[model samples]
Target: MRTAYSVETVRAAERELIARLPEGALMQRAAAGLAAVCAGLLRKVYGARVVLLVGPGDNGGDALYAGARLARRGAGVTAVAMDPERIHEGGLRALLAAGGRLADGVPARADLVLDGLVGIGGRGGLRPAAAALVERIPAGAVVVAVDLPSGVDADTGEVAGAAVRADVTVTFGAYKPGLLIDPGASRAGAVRLVDIGLSLPEPEVEALQDAEVGALLPVPTASSDKYRRGVVGVVAGSAQYPGAAVLAVSGALRGGAGAVRYVGPAVDAVLARYPETLIGRGRVQAWVIGPGLGTGRAAEVAEVLADPVPVLVDADGLRGLDPAVLRGRPAPTLLTPHAGEAAALLGVSREEVEAARLTSVRALAAKYGAVALLKGSTTLVSAAGGPVRVNPTGTPWLATAGSGDVLSGLTGSLLAAGLDAVDAASVGAYLHGLAARRAASGAPLLAQHIAESLPEAWRQHP
Candidate 1:
């Protein structure tokens, strides 16, 4: 599992490490790593043009020191400070000694540009001075951000205003939540971790790697039967959108569930698509409600909630949810909502939820006393407590009609197969995204394509 700590936690760790090390030693270690990455990106560091956007804090120092290293290797390096008086004296001296010069304005041509204007400590948006430097960056230059992209929140991944868009980000010590979640994640093109040797504590956010996800998957035993493997009950679709039921069942059948029992008015549509589906609910370990269910089905949603089994709610079922009723449930409940539905539940605007996805997901989880899965560019799974799991797999092509319905069924199947709320949601999202990437290699794909690719995604593991 990949873990990310808050800015506060990372600062504490950095301070402790700095106290024991010699003065300037910690900064030098960070600078060395930064320089190495830049060299690799340049391929031939000799005669390369490097521009460093220096700031008023340690981030600027890291860039200056790294620039000095490149200058020693015969690269023509230029440093542009946001404020000349506030620049780090030691770093500036080092760069000048190594043949690097201070530049009054951004050069028109450069092989690489280092965004050191702001680091993890900076908040809100960039000041006018820094934003101006960022705007002047030459096109086609490989922009590398030191630590994190400027104007992004290290803790929440929120971008209040103009932020740097980097081709690569070299983070030190630990990953920040902003690097893993959007819209900061989108700004951060690719991320590289540099170990500064700071011992850290539990992370506030985590992303499951492939191996971790494989371990969480349920494997049938030698003595297992259809019933033992688990059955998933799905209540979805209506006259208006019968395809939703077909798509949901398609995902459920491939989600490790031995059998799927479906209920609702779209019975004929589901049967015609999946003949193996058991019509009408019998005994099921979990239930998936909503998804093309249309409006005015609150009673059916309530009926499913009353059952003593895990339930995954999505789409139309997410409307007008009662927090107190969900909190009182005897079994686990997973709520999957896109930004719009999440906004409705939280009584906030969609723009607010999208801007602050981390906060919105956590708020939904705590308010309902259930696991909440916020689906978007970066899928997030969070419960009442514990670290929020960030899904690192997905393609922009996954954003399509009825795609969410497929996710709901897959997650419900995992819940039926005995995975806890968090694991079910996280693993489901991981596979769902991986499947989408496979299904839509670059072109547009239908919702059923994602469902069809689930088996191949599962085969990636043991």
Candidate 2:
């Protein structure tokens, strides 16, 4: 699994490592790694033009030292200093000795631009000068950010103002929460971690890798029967949106559930698509409620909640949800809500929820006493108190309708298969996102396509 640390923890780790190493040794290690990546990106360092946007901190020093290395290799490297007085003395001297020159402004043309404008310590967004310089970067340039993109919160992934949009970001030590979550994740187009040998504690957030997912997936044994595998009950869809039932059932069928007992008004539509569906309520290991069951399905929701089985609530089911109903439940429960739904549940605007996704999801989980999955640019799963699981695999194409219903069904099946609410939600989101990426392949795709692609995704993971 790929893990992410909070800014405070990362800073402490870096400090501890720095203290253990010789003076300037840690910086040299960072610079060496940075320079190596730059060399690789440049292909032939000789005669290549590289621009370094140097700020007034250690990040700038790292870039300056890297520029010195590139200069020695015969590259025409220019360091655009954001603050001349505060430049690293050692780094500046090295660059000058290696024939690198300081420039007032960026050159007209350059193959690469290293954004060392701000480090993890930076707050809010880019300062005026930095933001102006970032805007001047040529479109063709491959912008590689140092540590992380400038103007992003290393801890929260929040971007208050203008930020560097890098083609790739080479981070040191370990991953930060910002690098895995968005809008910082999006700003950091592609992230590569450079080892700086800092021993750290448990991460603040985590993304499960394929190996972990494969191990967690419920596999059948030779002696296992249909009942033993697990049964998932889906209470979703309404007359208004019969397609939701079809899609939810579509996902449940592929969700490793031994049998799917669907109870809703869209029974005919679901049966037409998945003929093997058990048609009505039965003894199920878990229940997935509220996906297009428009209002008026309160009785169905109550019945599912009354049962001792694990339950997943989503979409229309989240509307006017009573937190009291979910308090101190015997069985585990998961709530899947998109930004709009989450905003309504929290009595806040969608923008507020989007701005603080981690907090909102955690708050929802605590308030309702269930695992909450906030679905958006970054699908986050949070329980009452623990590190949020940030899903890594996804595509913008998943914005299509009916996607949540499919995810609800998928996660509910995992819950039935004996995984807890946290694991169930996280794994389901990962596979669901992976399926969308596979199905879309950069083109428009319907929600059904994602459901259809789940088997391929499941097999690929295992």
Model 2 lDDT tens row, 162-263: 999998898988998898888899999888888999899888899998998888888888988879989999988888988888888888888887889999
The lowest-lDDT stretch of 10 consecutive residues in candidate 1 is 119-128
lDDT of 1 by residue, 185-292 (tens): 999889999999999888899999999999988999999988898999999999999999999999999888899999999999999999999999799999999999
List CA RMSD, all candidates: 0.7, 1.2
Q: Which candidate is the best by TM-score?
A: 1
Global CA lDDT of candidate 2, please? 0.90
lDDT score of residue 415 within candidate 1: 91
The clash number for model 1 is 0
